[model samples]
Target: MKDAAKLFAYFFAVVIGGALLAPPLFWTAPHFSAFFAKFDFESFFHRALLICALAFLWPLLRSLRLRSFRDLQLDENRHALRDVVAGILLATVPLFVATIALIGTRIFLLKNAVPWNALGAVLAAAIVVP
Candidate 1:
């Protein structure tokens, strides 16, 4: 019952947080001309929110139990920056490679040349979203 209730609350939080955060995240996402013609803010935001929720859910659960930040197993060395950097790398590299491949294959639906800034923005989103 305790676990069930926690799950329910987490689910509710994800839905609500996703809805609230989606607009800003979608609005700020790098607007690149893609095969799709226009960015779908609604879909993008929802997806981003879901990804973030899944990625952070464990830490969220621990925090909810009133665990100290240090107790979260953030890192043994107590340096969280390294962990965060590692996480960003782990998340972004594959996505970056796949994005390149998709664009190269014309599967990404980019209608125009991908500008460096646009690519940078996408990379930023990729890093930040997870």
Candidate 2:
């Protein structure tokens, strides 16, 4: 049950974050083609993606009772910045690329209808690769 909850949280975060970020990308693509690189969608997409990735900690949270949290110990040398950045890059790149690719393929190839989100391909790759 705990593991299931963790996975559920992860999925929810990823899906929600991706969904929310999609609009800005699509919306701004045309108006700022020349300066698309300088766009400020990061605030939205980065937050969403980080939320999604951080959802992985749900299982760790579930592992502890309220008592565990109370009794938690910390390693003095532990640093979250490196780990967080790495996770963000990993999660962001794959998801953003996969989503964009899938969306593009579906939109351009399938008669301009986004009938199937690119998540299927992303899911398949995620499953197959690992």
lDDT of 2 by residue, 1-130 (tens): 5766766766786778666765666466547444344445644465446555666455556554434644567565477888889989998999979878988887534365764778686675444222
Candidate 1 ranges beyond 4 A from true positions: 31-37, 63-130
After superposition, the stretches of candidate 2 with alpha carbons farther than 4 Å from their true spots are 1-70, 107-130
Q: What would the per-residue lDDT of candidate 1 be over residues 33-90, giving only the tens digit for each residue? A: 3432255766666676776689669766674674667655654668689989999999
| Candidate 2 pairs with clashing backbones | none
The superposed Cα distance between candidate 2 and the true structure at residue 128, in angstroms, equals 33
How much lDDT does each candidate structure score?
A: 0.70, 0.61
lDDT against true structure, model 1: 0.70
TM-score of candidate 2 relative to the true fold:
0.29
What's the TM-score of each model vs. the native?
Answer: 0.40, 0.29
